[model samples]
Target: IIGCSIAFNLAKLGAKNVVLLEKEKMTGMGSTAKCSGGIRQQFISPANILLSIESIKIFKNWQDEFPYPVQYALDFRQAGYLFLLHSKSQIENFQKQMALQKKLGVVTVGFVNTHEISTALPYLNISGIVAGVFCASDGVADPASCCAEYEKQAKMMGVQFLTDVKVSDIGANGTTRRKIEVVFTNKGSMLTPCVINAAGPHAAQIGKMLNIEIPIICHRHQTIATPPIKWMKKNDPFVIDYDDYAGQEFYFRPEAGNENTGYQLLLGGHEDGKIQIADPDKYKEKIDQDFILYLADRAMNRFKEGENIQILTKSGIAGLYESTPDALPILGKTEEVEGFILANGFSGHGFMHSPIIGKIIAEIALSGRSSFDITGLGLDNFKTNTRPPAEKAIV
Candidate 1:
């Protein structure tokens, strides 16, 4: 979404020579389609929260801006994201984060005691739940549709897309200085002055082509959908349980049309940490049963609907959740390379922040800096041991 959107916005900014290359036969065939599509402003960092807040405005008013049907229904139930806390320390931490979020103009989040949590979600078993942070503005959407809309808009804006073409290498030229000369691809080479490494999971390999090492690894996260249930039709809010034993887990609104009939469920427990594939060409798609069961058990304890839910589909795909040393994303430029921009590492928050990322990347590519300050996301932060800590609320 970021790549195509950036290409589209660049054209809008009067850039005549913009092109997008997709290794797959179609755009968004990678992680964008597989995303859990949760959009939230309840983040630990001010930058993330601000981006999310701005993106929500775009998503809500998508139809008015774009010609084609972006299918702009956020289905955004302000029903809130309930995060259960089991420890006193965790509760205090959440309280601090809530205060920070509020200070940054994200006033939709707050700490709720076990009694309030049970009141909000009566079906929940709050035996071990001590406190919960509820963010009413946090919601979900259809990632596939959003990606398609971005591609459609880009195409309409005259951004040429080359699909089924793999970028083999990127050549640089200059005597003392450096400039991207040509992009060697499977079909042929293309001469371009600038390139964005929005290759998703394959970002590291793309960076390696230019002799730059990007700290990005691919992880397999599995999600399942359940057959329709009567009780779930009552409009259950997207629930997340963070009990000490429960760890991190999340469940969101169903797919756009299937919300009443069935709902999509996601569970992330890549116990193997992350599998590093040396070659991006060699990728695997397989779901782990043990991981699914672990997530199922966690969900069943809190949401009664999960207890008797019948699995309708089970599949897994390889997506890049680029992890920094501290698990936050590594955005901005690298010192080793100029004219080569990096927008790769998003951890799992890429899809939700796609709009903001697209605009920021386009701004950087066009104006050398984003209107919103991105100084905290520079690649140097990782090397200097000042990487921002991972947001505890994300699952």
Candidate 2:
């Protein structure tokens, strides 16, 4: 979505001959299609909070700005996100984090006590819950629909998309690195001044084609859905029970409708550890039912209402989290490669931050630098001598 959005914005700005290349037979067939589609501005870092705020604005008014329909109305309910806290120490920590978030101009985040949480979510069995944080602007959307819309809008704006054409290699020219030439499968070759690595799981490998070592790894996440239940509402926000013993193991929310059509649940188990894979094609897609049961057990312990829910479907996908040394993204340019730009490592927040990233990358590609200052996300931050602190609100 970020790549297509950037391409669309570039073409809209009168940049002629803009082309997009995809390795698959269709666009958004990769990890993008498997995202949970959660958009939240309740982050601990200032940069991420700002980016999410700006992206939410674009998502809210996409139809007004773009001529074509982006199919964004996949039940964007702002019922508010609730993060549970079981321990007193965790509650204090959340209070500090909420304070930082509020100081950074995040108006929707606030600390809520146990009584407030019980009153807000009557269905939840908050036996051990003490306090929590709520962010009204944090919500969910349909990932597949959003990605398709971006591609559709980009196509309408005269951007040529070449599917099933894998980028074989990229060749750079000039002694001081002035231009880049990309070689793809069916399209033959094309010379451009810039290239953006939005390849998701294969981003690090794409950087390796130019001998640049990007610190990113692939992680597998599983999601399940339940059969229709009467108590669940369609407009309920994405819920996170932070008090799980497994450490942020699960998240649940309504699918799209309110006629008791069931709810969708996403689980990231503690036992389902991340595995390092060099090739994207070698990923495993089959989900472990045992892991799902483990996560479901943890979730049911918190929300007793879930124990009787019937699971309708369960599936897994291989998506790259693209973790940095500090779990943040490496955006901007690298000193080792001249024309090579870095935009990979999003840690799992790529979808939520796609709009801001697209705009910033477009500005950098067209005008040689981003209007928004990205010095904190520079590639040199991972050079061992100067590493940035890890942002604490990644869950």
TM-score of candidate 2 on Cα atoms, chains taken together: 0.92
lDDT of 2 by residue, 1-395 (tens): 66776777777666778788898988777777767778888776777777788878877766765777555554555677778777878777877777877887778888888788777767788887778788988887776767777778778888898888888787765676445665445558887766777787778878877777888776656565555566666666677767544445456776644474544555453442433343567765655667657666866776758687566544544354666667677887767666677777777788888877877877777777887777678777777455456766655
RMSD of each: 2.9, 2.4
Colliding pairs, model 1: none
**lDDT, each prediction:** 0.70, 0.71
TM-score, every prediction: 0.89, 0.92
Q: Residue 205, candidate 2: how far off, in angstroms?
A: 0.9
Q: Best candidate per lDDT, number? A: 2
Candidate 2 minimal-lDDT segment of 10 residues: 269-278
Compute the lDDT for candidate 2. 0.71
Most TM-score-accurate candidate:
2
